[model samples]
Target: MITFPKDFLWGAATSAPQTEGAALLDGKSPSTWDKWFEMEPELFFDGVGPNDTSNVYVQYKEDIALMKKMSMNSYRTSIAWTRLLPDGKTLNPKAVAFYRDYFEEMIKQGIEPIINLFHFDMPWWLMEKGGWEARESVDHFAFYAKTAFEQFGDIVKKWATFNEPLVHIECGYMGDAHYPKVHDFKRAIQVGYHTLLAHAAAVKAYKESSQNDGEIGIILNLSPVYAKSEEPADQEARHKADLIYIRSFVDTVVHGYFPQEFIDLLEENQLLPETQAGDRTIFEENTVDFLGVNYYQPLRVQAVENPRFPAQSPGDFARYYDWPEKRINPHRGWEIYPEGMYDIAMRLKKDYYNIPWYVSENGMGVEGEEQFLDAQGVIQDDYRIAFLEDHLAMLAKAMQEGSQCFGYHMWTFVDCWSWLNAYKNRYGFYRLNREQNYARSDKASSYWMKQVIEQSGFEYGGHL
Candidate 1:
């Protein structure tokens, strides 16, 4: 008979680049994705690109109705910066009108819209002008955030300045998942620093302005790191991974400063990001009102003496290895450790001042989902049901133990195009049948989710 508070939020989350398909329509300019797909379409899986998404631009009304039918009390999605500002400065009137109508309709349907300003869809013009590496780019992002707030402030009350800034830093700067890929360690640190500065500036703008009276936050994809063995070297590697991957942004946003050990390591290695005098003060005064955590898996790390990269990357400290007894999602090849969710809740309560937060993104993505469809066209996703049930059980236990978690938002509402993976992995309540003009059909999980939301919790062993 476990139950959640009556006010607990149940929602679904999506992003602009993954869902919105009208890439160049309505005065929308070229994002890095549009340009990247133009240049290197081969890099994208199955040659599918950004503009081939689920067509939310044309189907948003139907989608919102689906969300309402599914009993979603709230919805989270981002505004494409490219769509809003064609040249990085001016606000397109059409873009403004579209978002206003979009938010209003959700509100009318009894669903709260939580809008994120940036979701890694960096404007191509900005990328050409040095992107997050150039200090001035921070100001440009702040301007975008300000414009979004002023325009949509009347309709949308909850705002997120950025979604997974760490992904923007790691995947874009240090790996190949995002555009303008470079592997310079110092530049990676700079991108992280400038991104945080942009976040701080946006937080400050939201608080100072009288345009919107909503809470502002950032979404982070955080994971708990575990050492491979109980050795001194392995422990050191785990600590290093924690600092680089977790503490860098979390500490700055919550505690208003970088971890001293993190700074010391960067300084010792000459990889510290260049910063101005007033940046510290900005972070100090403009901490966020809440946090949105996107957890998928925990990290497993061991000390690296020989290291994979040429000592220039963060690889010198740690290297990843598979945990022996790990249960994996065969389709996505990602670890599925539900207990990590409990560890995350307790860590936040113990270390991060018990800040108000939520499971902003969590879901199971399976490949080749059509084979599971029953005669009624519902994808019988018992795996997804079990995956969510186990995680939600952990969440319930954590809440009972006094975590400040306020909500749980599934990864998405509909099957949409992933960044580089394209439609290789589908994580959605409704399966999108692209052959039928992106027509969505219910998966078994959708009805199950509605029951969970209606009951405010699910039973241990029951039909739902």
Candidate 2:
């Protein structure tokens, strides 16, 4: 049987706005998501928005108890900036008390809490100040990060500065799916640069502050790209995709600088982000202690003759050709490529000096998951169980070959609101009943996960 290291951490991840429903309660202010919903409620699935979410603010205690029951040794969650600093400056005492008590309870139950500072929920006021595109916003985020560390650093030692930084740059700035939807290449570059700088600044503050015992890192959603064929053009397409999506963030955060190739390409296109003095030193000195990888699928790419200016946000610099023959997650319209997980780990080993990392967010979201409930009232999520097993086996193979990955946290804990998609798809091991006051019930996958945690691993089987 395959097994993991003795200290392997098994847990689930959850973000604040997706789970905590007290949008306007307890002196909390509006997040960018709240404001977005107000502007375009119809954009969200079934008109459900950020205001409608699982009541984690009130039920965190019960949730912590449920985590223990699930045999989880760790948990990943984000603190809402709007909740802590209503205006992104003034500290809300009530927010502080709630967070301290919530974190304390998680620690008391023998669960390690890994906290993330930002998860796409910028304070509405910050967005009003041009968000990450403005230079001043970087300092504001750094201040928020320092405040969080100063307040809750004792219990939460594993801190992620931001979750999926590239996602924000792609969706919010390039694609029209997220808030502040602006399809501008120059703006995307600016926002992305500032986000990376903000991350570096947070790392610097963490080091300069009294909270020096903990590690700070960032989470990135990485999809390994493969050339559709051995053609030279296809290979070039794959490289361009990697440059924009993966290496752009990985190279800077881990190596403390942007890749020369990326810089050259930006210069050629006149799309370089505006930089300031000493920004280079901040990045060079504040490289992350660890990295978080969120992989769900591999990107299959082929070259195109004429790439468009506004290339669907991320694909702007490269052309994309689909793999029609690949196995598919019919429920979610994503490719099911378990080997991508192993490929990512191997890349980290060879290219990034094997810095310690973990699968921070990886799971399959199924549409209308409640329909899978059986006569006994249990959701038979055999598909999800199989999906995890396939991916975990790949991760296990990488670890045996010496990848420095220490933990594996699923995408989420409870079924909660997904941005734009809302509650249309559920990724949680524990299903939520929206009609019944957001009551949660464990699915078969939850019990299966408990077994995996208890055994520390499982026998390898062919991908489902």
Candidate 3:
């Protein structure tokens, strides 16, 4: 049996806009998502919008009970900025009361809550005022962060300022798949720099707050970069992609400064983000106490000969090279390489001073999970079980070699609504029965996970 540490955290994760159904209720204004979905209903999957979520805002109590049933000791979720402070200036009393009580219930049930302040759901007004592109959005986000700390910091000790800010930067600004779609690389870099600036400000706010007894960090989807070949250009491609995608955020958050090489590259390309005088001090003074790494796949690339996409974007830095032998999650079209986990841990151990971290998200999202349901009505998700086993075993090996990973959170607890994908792909311990008003039901993986958590380990090679 590969056992984990006694105090290891085991749970799942969720975000607000993806799960909370009451998009515009109780003084909650519309987010960019709400506005965008209204503008282009056809863009979403199966005609589902943010308003048709899993109803976690109303079903959180029952969801907490479901977590307890799954033997989860912790859960990572985000506070909807639109819900808590719709206008981004004033706090809603009802929202504040609901969050306090919600967090209290989770804590009371022995499930520690790692509450994140933002999860890509920008307020509609803020987006109207230029979102992360404008310099002023940084200050607005800082104020919002301070407000969150003032309101809920006492109960929510493990605070993450943003979840996967990189995705926000790349997808939203680069004309990819998010809101305010624009293919402006200059604005993208500005967004990236300002987002980090806002992160530093949030960290500073957390440190200055009275309830400063806990850690403040950022969750980044850090994918390991691999060279497609031994050629010098391919190796350069790997380094460039790594710097742009992984190190650009990890180094700033952990090492407390923007990478000089990346800065130089941007400057040489005339893509450097405009910076203020005192911004350097905020970043240098308030580095993170820990980090949340979200791993889904690794980057395999070669030198940019022919870019993958026509637009000039980050993907152009190192064009993806298809590897014949790479295994892929056919449902999601993402490569499946469990070795990336070990690589991530070792890199953190060897380079980042072995700072505290956790696998904030690692799970498989299979299309049509209900097709796996057996005669007993329990979804037999053996594919998901194998995915977890492979990743966890790799993480265990990394731990034996001295990786400072504290927990492992699956991508989601309930098959919550994905942003544009809606409920097309399911990644949950408990399947969300959409046809029956999002009723929850245990899956075969849930039963298997309970045994793993109860035993603190599992015999993986044998059948359960």
Candidate 4:
């Protein structure tokens, strides 16, 4: 029987906009997501936008009972910026009370609460005023962080400043996939840099707060990049891809500064972000106490003859992006390589002082086309179980190799609305029926995860 250490944390993760339903209640203003769903509903897949997803804002009591049923000892959830502080400047007492009560309930049920400050839910007011690209938004974010620390820090000790800041840069700024869609490489770099500065300012604010043992950090979705071949061009392509995609955020957050290679690349392309004089010192001195690593899939890179520039470019010889040929899961259309987890852990250990870290979010998403009718009308999700098993085995191997990895939390607890995909790719142990007032039913993976949590490890051929 494979066993994990007794102190290992077993939990599930959920974000506010994805799960919570009360988007316009209790003086809570609309966030960018709420505004996007209202203005451009057609942009979302399946014609479903974040109206009242899973109704977790109201059904959190029942959700906590579900967590208890799953034998979960830990849970990760993000604070809705607009929910806590409308207009990103003023705090809502009712919102603070609701979260405090919810957290108290979780503690009463013997579950540890891991609170993340921002999960891509920027307030509409802030977005209207230029979002992260503007310096005022950074100051507003620092104010929100300070307010959160003062109000919720008494009970919530584990604080995460931002969740997957690189995703915001890549998808929202560089690519047009996410909301506030802008396709400018320079703006993406500037937004990414400003995000790090905000994170550092928040960390510094948390350090100065009255909470003595409060731990603060940032969450990064660290996907290890691999070259397709041993050719010089392929290797160089991989390096460039890593610098742009992964190292830009990782090096800055962990080492408190951007890599010189990345700066040189930005300079060569004339895509360098605007930076103030004291910004470097803010990042360097205010590094996080821990890191939350979200591993989903590895990026496979190959040398490209001509890289497509999302922004206006001045070069003809600039290389483009290409993916390495790899096996992808039929259900999710993502590469299923478990060794990427090991590579990520090892890279963190070798390069980032081996700081205390945890697998904040990792899971599989499957389009459940064939819905099975179990006794309670549950869908059997054996594919998700298999995905978690493979990845967790890699995590166990990394732990054995002396990586300072702490715990693992799946991507979500219940199937909720994804940003643009809506509910197309379901990544949850429990399934939610959006039509029936967001009714929830536990899938087979829910029971499987319960057993895994109870045993603290996986055993082959043991009733999954």
lDDT of 4 by residue, 147-208 (tens): 98888888888989999998887789867777789887778778888888999999888888
lDDT of 2 by residue, 112-214 (tens): 9999999999888888889999899999999999999999988789999999988888798877888799898889999999999999999999999897798
TM-score to native of every candidate shown: 0.98, 0.98, 0.98, 0.95
> What is the lDDT, from 0 to 100, of the residue 248 in candidate 1?
93
Model 3 CA deviation exceeding 4 Å by range? 306-311, 462-464
Model 3 TM-score relative to the real fold: 0.98
lDDT of 2 at 242: 91
- Per-residue CA lDDT of model 1 for 173-268, tens digit only, reads 888889888888889999999999999999998887777588998999889999999999999999999999999989989889999999988888
| Candidate lDDT values, in order | 0.90, 0.89, 0.90, 0.83
Q: What is candidate 2's local distance difference test score?
A: 0.89
Per-residue lDDT tens digits for candidate 3, residues 1-464, read: 87899799999998988898899989999998899999998999998999999998899999999889888899999999888888988889989988998899999999999999889998999998899988998888888899999998889899999999988888898875899888888889999999999999999999999989989999999889999889999999899888898889999999889899998878767788899999889989999999999998888998887764433677667888898998888888888899999999999999999989999999999997788998888999988898889898899989999999999999889999888999999999998987998899988888888889888988868322
Task: Enumerate residue pairs that collide in model 1.
Answer: none
